[model samples]
Target: MSVIGVVASATGGVEQLREGLVRPLLDREHQVAITVTPTAAAWIAPAERWELERITGLPVRSQPRRPGEARPHPPIDLFVAAPASANTVAKLALGIGDNQALSVLSEGLGSTPMVVFPKVNAAHARHPAWAGHLDTLREAGVVLVEWELLEPRTEAKRELPWDRVLAAVDGLADQFFQGRLRDRGAGVADGGDG
Candidate 1:
């Protein structure tokens, strides 16, 4: 089973954990692990964590592991950051991994297939640095699933669009695996690359 890492930031997307990610991963018989930002962990309800743990059977972590500590989660093949915050996007693109969630995301950049849903507000979306960061991420093969434009709303979830985020990541991961298999087959048939 493929292992997927779900990183949640302190935004409305955190609210979509179970339905948008956990259940879908479980339904696919994939193993799921979660890492949250410190503020994001505080945003989660205890009942939510209990339900997620029940499904994943993996402890959710928000802090970096101490030196020599056993790594609790498996190395992920696919990574998704939903409700990704502006802070998260900038740090990821700039190679700043000050938190557990960001570190996981940064480490997965090229090796692991990644999908990021930035929960940016209209004001932040207009910032000059915003487009550049997104550009850098897209250049690195990080797919971005953003909300369809509409009249601005104050409610956060309206901007988050977890459903779209989930679908985008699934489609991207499928494409990634298909390409990998095709490449491997071609290499074998051609008697390797020399």
Candidate 2:
């Protein structure tokens, strides 16, 4: 079974995003695991979890961990961090898996596809380190979905386009499956028993 792991920061519309994506996956009978970061849990309530359970029929699990706890590897076929915070982005890039979210990424088995959806303001996203980190991930074959086209004014509210975001999610899933299949082939060749 294909496992799609969705991880999000405690930002606006995170639950809505998760709900939206999970619905389609459920309709198609795909396995979806919704993992919330520590920051995400602070804002999401029990009511929200109940709502998600109703909508997706999938139990929502939070990866509550501090800076040093080891993360559990759930055989993640594809890992996605949406509305990704700048702090989390930096931590992932620098190999600083201090929290559950970052820690899970580190513990992900080799050849597991990873996607990062950055939701920071345009200015923050343009930082040298951020840009470099993104480039590094790309070179390492990690898919990055950045909202650079949106221009946030000084007093403007940042809003992500759901349509575009969903489309990006679909694209990431495609890439992830391709990578996983290639890796499976490699594994088989290393020790073929067939």
* Residue lDDT tens for model 2, 71-148: 443467777777677777777777787766777776662356777777676777767777897777777667777655
Query: Which one wins on TM-score?
Result: 1
State how far residue 188 of model 1 sits from its true place (Å).
5.3
All predictions: root-mean-square deviation over Cα?
2.7, 4.2
TM-scores, in order shown? Answer: 0.88, 0.75
Candidate 1 Cα outliers beyond 4 Å, as residue runs: 149-153, 156-160, 183-194
Tens-digit per-residue lDDT, 118-177, candidate 1: 877777788899999999999999989887443356643443566677687779878987
Clashing pairs in 2: none
| 23: Cα error in model 1, Å | 0.9
Q: What is the C-alpha lDDT of each candidate?
A: 0.85, 0.68
Worst 10 residues of 2 by lDDT: 149-158
Model 2, residue 49: distance off in Å is: 2.0
For candidate 1, list the clashing residue pairs, or say none: none
